[model samples]
Each structure stands twice: as structure tokens, then as C-alpha cells.
Target: MRSLVFLVLLGAAFALDDEKIVGGYECKPYSQPWQVSLNSGYHFCGGSLVNENWVVSAAHCYMSRIEVRLGEHNIVITEGSEQFIYSDKVIRHPNYNSWTLDSDIMLIKLSKPATLNQYVQPVSLPTGCATAGTNCSVTGWGNTMSSTADSNKLQCLEIPILSNSNCNNSYPGMITNTMFCAGYLEGGKDSCQKGESLSMDRRNKKEEEGKKEEEEEGEKEEEGKKEEEEEGGKKEEEEEGEKEEEGKKEEEEEGKKEEEEEEEEDKEWKYLMKFEQQS
Candidate 1:
């Protein structure tokens, strides 16, 4: 349950570079076809369509007054293609921890399937998490600047994926099996602003050859996550030499961390000095 205005944009460049979720540009209509806005009567969190009848979002933004709006660029005006649907079912992950924000995922089941059109489509769930260098795009109707007020259009930016270890540094002891991190290393653009939505999806191609993975069903998905994590682990040591300064703040905290605790934090941050550092 949150709010926002809309943003206007020119052509899009998918290449990754210096940009801000904080310094993001408002998205033009049709540029992002899979984003959805979760309305809790007023403002809302960002979401993505997994299928015609289901949408996924963060559990931390949960509220009772939930509604799903698709093909929406601005909330104030109603366009012909925009479809408003009520949530028939809301399932926060069984293991979702409110305090730690672990497994921050929720599923919204619409009363009926949304009609597929040019403006509305589902984002493909990768067979596994994206690799370290993948440029994942996050879009939302959050604030244009750092402040709480949102714009009239959706905002989007491409952020490279950071490993679990690097992500854990930002949120002490918070990263989990179901979550992967992506944001500016220096803290610029981010879609999780006040009154904004956190809509995101991976742009990687689906693995058609991996259809056999459907056999194990749930078991296979867990394996895929492990594989992705291991793939990123290859360059962990190289990243540790850098990123030492940015972590000093998180390192300082309020009081001293025990020797054992410091040891663990170091273990997690040994990779992902920056999202684009693989080169």
C-alpha cells in the first residue's frame, strides 16, 4: 500500500552504466510490459506478473487494502488497456520472516486471468537465479528523487546483480536463499523509495533445453539457486581487496562487533566489490 505520479521517457538503452534508481528516468508506456502496481487503496509497492492470474511482490510492503493494476503508467488516469483486478488470494512465503525481511516475497492471485495483450505479459522465471554479470532491470512508480513524493509515470533502471555475500553487507544477516541483491555500489539509484513500487524482472532467456528439470519439480529449483550462487563464487577473493572503504560505515555500526562476528561479516563480503567488476 503506497503511492506515486508518472514519468515520461525517450528511447531506452539496455546497456548498464552509471544510473540511479535514485537517479532514474521515468519510463514510457510499453517500454516495460511486465510491471504491475500493488495498490493498497492509495500508494503501492511494485510487482511483476508470473502468469496471467498471479503477481509477485515483496512481503515487507504487505497491507490489507490490496489491489492489482496492470498496464498502468499513471494511477490517476485510466487507459483502455489498463486492467484493475482484486486479489483473490495473497500468500506470503511460508518462511517469510517479518523482522529480518528474509524471503521477502508474496504472491497475489487475481480473481480472473488477465487478458494477454501487447501492454501486459508475464516475465519468465529463470531456471535459476541470474549470473553475477547479468543486468537485471527494476522498475516502479517510486519517487523520482530521494524524497517521498512520486512522479506521474513509472521509473526504471538496469542494476547488475550482487552476490549474497556482498548483499549481506548492506543488510546485516538479512540475505536469504530466496533473495539476491542488485543496486548501485555507491548508493545512487534504487526503486525502493518512499511511495514507490519495487517492480522487477530478469531479462535472461528461458532455458528451453532444461524443460527436463520439471521432473524433480520443487527440488530442481533449490538446486538451481545453489548453482547460481556457486557460479558467482568464482571471483569472491578478488573483490575483497576492493570495497574495503564502503564497508567501513557498516563496519562501524553502533558498537564493536565480537571477533567471531567480524570474522563472519568478512566471509560474506569477500565478493562483489562492485556489480560491474567482473571485467
Candidate 2:
């Protein structure tokens, strides 16, 4: 069987951020404007507002009907910066394979433009590549520890970007070009939860997709050229066949004319022989 990757929206929603917490610190409400929570009934996953109408997140974090909470802090208490709205559309990466978790990214289109304020805003994309050992921040509403309950308020933690070689040693044959490792090698404060929307360099992903498209286009052009050449060859063969048929018809007509002349000459000689006999 050719394995096909299918997207399934599990009715259950537990924040992976819920799963990956250990010693996470709490933050004040409305501090991170671009930070958003995807809430179906409760906060399921974290997302970022890349545009007024778009939210970028992990494909693994999909919900059937998403209620977007922007400028949200604590899920339990209501705040002024909090804007709750329904999503207009949900689009997963075209090449996303749920089984492989390959290209695990998704985009949500908002029905209405998010009202950008101090509490609700967009995050800027990285201009350059992240160097190994650089400290970066990760935020989510996951549990503080494996034994504890999932947090109602948002939390943030600082983790270092691990070098590919070092990360490979830790995970061993699991890292991919679409994925990288970022967390403490010691493993005390890692975002251990099925934390949605780990900071991935989406620009690199887009560039890779573009390169694949260009290669496919080149192959299509080559195939088209081959087809045209085959058609031209068939046309030439047809013309040669017609020429040969015409030559055979002309030879047949010449042969008939020669036989008629010979028959007429024989008749004339016979008539002359009869006249001589009569004289």
C-alpha cells in the first residue's frame, strides 16, 4: 500500500506546551502582542500573528473550529487586550504529512482583521539564520512540569540553539532539514510539551518549496520537447510513403502504353500480309 498522509482533527485538545514545561516562569498579561492562543473550548496550542488576517502555527495543532485569542495572557481570567474571534479558513502545508510530521506548519485565515493594539500585534520574521549557541525565547501555556496541571497563564523560557552535529547526537537520526534542535542539552528546562509553533525558519521552508517547483517546471519542458520531436518524425515518414506510392502509379501507366503500341503494330502487319496474299 502506498502510504498516504491524512490530516485528522482529534476532538481532544491538550497543549503540547502543556506537555513540555519544567520550571517555566509566568509573564504579565498583554506583554507579547504577537503571541496568540488557539482555543476550541480551552487553549489547545500557541500561534503567532504574522499578519492581521493570518496566524502561523504547527499542523499538528489543528482544531476543527478555532477560536483565536489574541493579546491573551491567562486563559482563566479575562483581560482587555484579549480579542476572541472565529477563524475563516484553515490551510495546512501542501506537502504536510501528519504521519511523518514533515513540514509541520499551518496557516489560519481570520474572518475579520485583528484589531492591532498594544495587546494584539504581529511578529517580525528573522532577517538572517540563527547561529548555534544563540539564546532564543519560547513561550506557551503548557504545564510547568510533567506532574503539574497545564497553566492558565502564558509562560516563557530561554533555550539555546544546538548545533546540528550536537543535536543529531542527542536525537540520533531524527533531525531533518525542515527541523532543528533548540533546547538545553542538560534537559532541565526544555519545552517538552507537544508545544505548538516552535520557532522555525519559515523563510527557508518557502525557498526550498520554490526550488522544487522550478525543477518540476524544467522536467515538464523537456518532456514537451520530446513529444514535439516525435510528432515531427511521424509527419516526415508520412510524406515519404506518399511519394513512393505516386512513383509506383507512374511506372504502371508507362507499362500499359508500351503494351498497347506493340499490339497495334502486330495488327498492321497481319493486314499487310492478307493484302499480299489477295494480290
Pick the lDDT winner: 2
The C-alpha local distance difference test score for the whole of candidate 2 amounts to 0.69
Candidate 1 achieves a global lDDT of 0.61
Per-residue lDDT tens digits of candidate 2, residues 136-182?
A: 56777777766667788888766667788986787676555666667
Q: Could you give candidate 1's per-residue lDDT for residues 14-106 as a string of tens digits? A: 111212256677777866666787787765566777789987776655665578888888767877779888889888879877665555567
Q: Which residue pairs come into collision in candidate 2?
A: 16-193, 16-194, 17-142, 18-142, 18-143, 19-193, 20-192, 20-193
Cα-based TM-score, every candidate: 0.61, 0.63
lDDT of each: 0.61, 0.69
- Candidate 1 lDDT trough over 10 residues, lowest sum: 4-13
Task: Count backbone clashes in candidate 1.
Answer: 19
Query: CA shift at 263, candidate 2, in angstroms?
Result: 99
